[model samples]
Structure formats: structure tokens, C-alpha cells
Target: MRKINYKDITNQQLIDVRTQHDYQAGHLKNSLNLNPGNFKTYATYYLDLNQPVIFIVGSEEEGHLEELSESANELGFNQKNGYLLIDEVPKEDLQTTETILAEDFLNKSDDFILLDVRHPDEITRPAPEKNLVNIPFEDLVNDYQSLDTSKQIFTLCGSGNRSTAAASFLESKGLNPKVIEGGMKAIQEIGK
Candidate 1:
């Protein structure tokens, strides 16, 4: 197994092994779909070795970076370079929707913007009571200007996958956005 460093993966190409329900709920930018259950066939026929690949899943429930790293090695991907991560993990206390809702989101509709980071297909359908702005996870970086970076923002998706990535990117740019932990599912339950 070839050893690679995590810092080298600046292109952000990811391989998802979680369920389809998890993927459609939200995913990383430029990610290629691969179910871990069928990874051998998928990797044998579909994986592109030239591009740097990071293995990901919905959450640690899917196994942390250790599991992903091991799988990537078995699939003949660069073990040294591959990353293992839950699509949504809390970063500093502000990375989860639950944390935001408990302290900030419930009280600050006037001061913050609610951004939905799911695909257009999900956002255009019936949604929860929370006022939300639609910007798919994959498009967030490209269409970032469409969002007002100066304000405090709250981002969510169907399952919190895309929202986490969206929140992190926005934060890296100096915008303090809160991630809705479970994404739309949590929002819907809260509204009900």
C-alpha cells in the first residue's frame, strides 16, 4: 500500500461509499460515487488512479478515516494519500445544526440567513417551515457570490452531508456559518 499525506489532496476529489440515501441527502464537491459494499467491482472498473481520491461516508457511523483508509488500500488506491472522514463532523462547537439550534438559530432569524445545501431536486420539493436559500453543495463554491458572506449564515441539507462542507468552506472565507447537524431532516422534525 502506498502511503500518501492528507494535506496533498487540494483538488477535493472524493469517493463516497455510503448509501444512495446519504449521497442524495448531500455530498462533497467533485466527489465520485462508489458504494463500499461493492467497492471491488466499482474500483476495478470505474476508479481513476490519476486523480487524488479521498474516501468518505455519511458519518462515523460509516466508519472514520481508518476504515476508509483501509478500504482505499484494498481497492488499489494510494493508501498514503487517501483521506477518511464522515461527510459531516462537528468543527469547533459551531459545526452542527443541533448546537446552532440550541443556542443561536432558534433565536436569531433576523440576524442570520438559512441556506439549504442540498441538490436543486430536494430544495425545490416540499420543505420545512424554516426560511432557506437554495444552493446545492456541489455548486456552493462556484455560486458562492450568490450568498452574502458578510452575514451570519446557517446551512443545512437533506442529511447534513453537504451542509457541513458548505459551512466549512464559508467559514474558511471568514464567514461564520452554522451547520445544521442533521440537515433538512432535523429541520423538518424541529418545525413539526
Candidate 2:
């Protein structure tokens, strides 16, 4: 487990090991939210083992970093480039990404590209809108080039977890992506 200052971790992939609500409020730019419980599964499926990754936890107390690092190691992510305590980073340095509510997104469906990043099994049931493009989260980094960069992308997932991660990845690639807040779950509730 390596430790580094936030200033030193430049231009590397950052994974935020914090709660979804905390992550949604603010996080380091280009950082992907990977809840501790889901870190191993998501990392194994979507992340590149060879890419250097920096983990940022909400705090240092109570073994948060230890637990997160243990999970990462279990998934074969042996090389942890660095770990940072979130409190050490300045609030101004943290950035929040744009999000569109499910209701608003459904109402103005034609205004943007609805990119569903959920797995095929999750998307088997069709979306209320017909203009959705399915590119599972795991396939996004490699398949993003196939999308039309001119259009604004609104990413969706089962909930907002995967979508937030997908949006961050897209933003890192210089593409603008707005995550749909609450994702398909919110859309379903609105429909109900």
C-alpha cells in the first residue's frame, strides 16, 4: 500500500472509495466512484489491471484505506499507485460532474444521446425511450470512439453507480457525459 500526496498523483486513474452520496456531492476530477462493497467486482470487470490507480478514501481513521486496499488486492489489483485521505485534499480541488434527473431526461429524450452503460442482462427490458445506445460499462473505454462525439451523452445504469463511473471515464477521454441521477431506478419510480 503506497501513500502519496494528491498533488503528486497527476494524470493517473483515480478511484474514490466513498459512499455513493458522498461521491455524488464532490470528488476529484476524473475520479471513478467505487463503493468498497462493489470495488472488487467492478474493478475485475471494468478496470485495466496494468493501469496505475490511485485510491482516495473519505478518511484515514477506522481502517478505511486498509479495507479498500484489501478488496483491491483480492481482485488482482496488486499495484496501488497511491492512496490519499480525502480530507487532505482541498475542497476547491474537488469537482462535481453534471447530472440530469431521470424525469427531466425522459421528457427531453431527443435533445441528447441516451447512452446506457448497464450490462446486457440489465437492459434486456427496453427503455421507455427508443433512442438509447447500449454500451455496457465494461466495454465503454474501448468502444467510446464509436459514439458520436458531437452529441451530448447522458449515461445510465441500473442505479447511478455504474453510470457515474462511465461518465468519469468518458470525461477522462475528453468527451462530455452527463450522468442520469438515480439512473434506471429513478426512471422506473417516475413511471410508476
Among all candidates shown, the one with the greatest lDDT: 2
Q: Candidate 1 lDDT, tens digit per residue, 1-192?
A: 233343444664566666544543455444544566445544544345555566665553345456555666676765244554543333331122223552345556474567876777656434444565777666766777877766667877776655655664564455666766666666566766
Error of 2 at 2 (Å): 4.9
Candidate 2, residue 175: lDDT = 83
Per-residue lDDT, model 1, residue 168, is: 49
| Worst 10 contiguous positions by lDDT, candidate 2 | 59-68
Local distance difference test scores for all models: 0.56, 0.78
Error of 1 at 114 (Å): 1.0
Query: Following a full C-alpha superposition, what root-mean-square deviation does model 2 have from the true structure?
Result: 2.5
Candidate 2 regions off by >4 Å?
44-48, 60-64
Model 2 Cα lDDT, one tens digit per residue, 63-156: 6677767776766775656787788899999877788888888888355678988888867546656567999887887898999888899988
Error of 2 at 163 (Å): 0.7
Model 1 error, position 76 (Å): 14
The TM-scores of all predictions, comma-separated, are: 0.52, 0.85
